[model samples]
Target: MIDVLVAGGGPAGLAAAVHARLAGLTAVVVEPRTAPVDKACGEGVMPGGVASLRALGVEPAGRELRGIRYVDGVRRAEAPFRDRPGLGVRRTTLHRALHERALGLGVRIVPGKVGEVRQTRDSVTAAGITARWLIAADGLHSPVRRRLGLELPGGPRGRYGLRRHYRLAPWTDFVEVHWSGQGEAYVTPVADGLVGVAVLSRVRRGYDEHLDGFPAL
Candidate 1:
C-alpha cells in the first residue's frame, strides 16, 4: 500500500504529497478536477509561505510583493516584510507549480474523488485505493469528512469571497487592502500585466455590489 493517500489535488494535498516524498514515503493524490485547478482567492503568498515553497524546490513565476498596504478612505498604512519578500501569484500558477513539484518527486496523481472512506487501526481505504494513512485535504466541505462521520455541524453564515483578474499593470509592489463598512477588497499583482481583485463580505450580494463597498479600489 502507498504510504499516503491524499484526497485532493489542490495546493494542500500536493504539498502533503511533496513532503511525503521528501521523507521517502510513497504518496498518491486523488483529485476529480483537472490539473492546474483555479480558485477564488487573494493569490498572495506571504514570506513564510514563499520560504516553505523554496525549501520544497517549487518556484513559480509572478510578481514580488514587498509589503502590505491598507486603505480606509483617505487613511492608508503600509508594512514591509522584515526579511523576505512575498509572492503575488495566480491560483492556477501556484497550483501548477505545486503539482509539478509533487510529480517531480515521484508522487502519483489520479483523477478521482475520495468517497465513502473506510478506516481501521492500521490503514484507510477509499475510492478503490488503500493506503497506510489517508489525508482529507479535499476542501472545506469535504465529502470524506462527512462519510467518515468527522464533519462538524454547520456554523453561522460567514464571509464569502469573490475574485477576478484584470489585464493591467500593477500600480505597486505591495498587496493593497481596501476597507469599507460592508466588506473588504484585496488587490494583488499576480503577473507582469495582470492584477487580481478579491472581495470578502458577510452580506449576500452580487460581486458588483461587493465591489461597490471599495470604491477607492
Candidate 2:
C-alpha cells in the first residue's frame, strides 16, 4: 500500500508527491495525461512559488522576471519586486521538471483516470489502489471532490482566460499587463525567444479581437 495517493499529475499533485516522499512516505500519482502536459496559464511563478519549488529541488528553465508593469493606452505603472525575481516558465516545462524530480525520488506515477474512490477509517482507495491518505488535486472540477460531496456551488459568470505563445524575443524583463476596455492581456517571457500572452475577459471574443486593441504588443 502507498502512503499517499494523488489524484492528479498537475503541479499540485506532483508537488504533493514530492513533499510526501521528502517526508519519508511512499506516494503514487494517478493521472490520465502523460508527462509535459500543457495548459493555459499565466506562466509566471511568483517569487514565493519559486522558492517553494527550489525547496523541492526542482527548478525549471525559464526567463527571469524582474517586476510587473501595467499599462493602458494613456497611463502606465510599474512595480519592482522587493525580494527575488519571479520566473516565467511554460506549463509544459514546469510539469516535465516536476515529473522528473518525482520519478527520481521514487514516486510512482500511474497512467489512468480515477473512476471511483472509496475510503475507510484507516485508508483510501482510488482507481483500485489503496493508500493511507488521498489528495484530490484534480483541478477546479475535481471528480474526487464531487464524489466526496465537497464541491461548492458555482459562482457567478467569471472571466475567461486564453493563452498563446509567440516566437519573439522579450522586449522587457517585466510581465506587462495591458488593460483594454474589454479585457486585460498578460505578456510573459517564458523562454529566450518565446513569449506567452494570456488574455482575461468576461466578454467572449477571439484572440485577434483582443490583440487588435494593443497594437504595440
Candidate 3:
C-alpha cells in the first residue's frame, strides 16, 4: 500500500505527490490524461505562486510579468509588484514541469482514473490500488467528491473561461485585464512570441462574442 493516492495528475495532484515524496512517503497518482495537458486558463502565476513552484524545485520557462494592468476603455490602472516579478507560463509548461519533478522524486504516475473509491478505518482503496490516504484533486466537478457525497449545494451561476493563443510579441510585461459589461478578458504573455487571451463571464456565449465585448483589448 502507498502512503498517498492522488486521484488526478494535474498541477495540484502532482504537487501533492512531490510533497509526499519529500516527506518520505510513497505516492501514486492516477490520471487518465497524457502529460503536458492543456486547458483554458489565464496562465498568469502570481509572485507568491511562482515562489511556491520554485520551492518545489519546478521552474517553467515563460515570460516574466512585472505587474497587472486593468483597462476600461480609455481609463486604466496599473500596479507593479513591490518585490519580485510573477510568471506568465503556459498551463502545459507548468504541468510538464511539475510532472517531471514528481517523477524525479520517485512518485509513481499511473495512466488511469480513480473510480468507486472505498475507504475503511485505516486505508482507502480506489482503482485497484490501496493507500493510507486519498487526495481528490480531480477538478471542479470531481467524480470522487460526487461519489463520496461531499459536494456542496450550487450557489449563484458561475463564470466560464475560454482561452486562446496568438502569435505576437508581447507589448507589455504586465498581465492586462480588459473589462466590459459582459465579461473580462485577460491578456498575458506566455512566451517571447506568444500571448494568451482568456475571457471569463457568467453569460453563455461564444468566444468571439465574448471577445467582442472587450473592444479595448
At residue 106, what lDDT does model 2 achieve?
99
Q: How many residue pairs of model 3 clash at the backbone?
A: 0
For model 2, name the residue pairs that clash.
none
For all the candidates, what are their Cα RMSDs to the real structure?
1.7, 1.7, 1.5
Error of 2 at 179 (Å): 1.9
The TM-score leader among the candidates is: 3
Winner on lDDT (2 vs 3): 3
Query: What lDDT does candidate 2 reach at residue 135?
Result: 95
Considering TM-score, where higher is better, how would the candidates rank from best to worst? 3, 1, 2
TM-score of each prediction: 0.93, 0.93, 0.94
lDDT of each: 0.91, 0.92, 0.93
Provide the lowest-lDDT 10-residue window in model 3: 150-159
TM match of model 1 to true structure: 0.93
In candidate 3, residue 203 scores what lDDT? 90
On the 0 to 100 scale, the lDDT of residue 217 in model 3 is 62
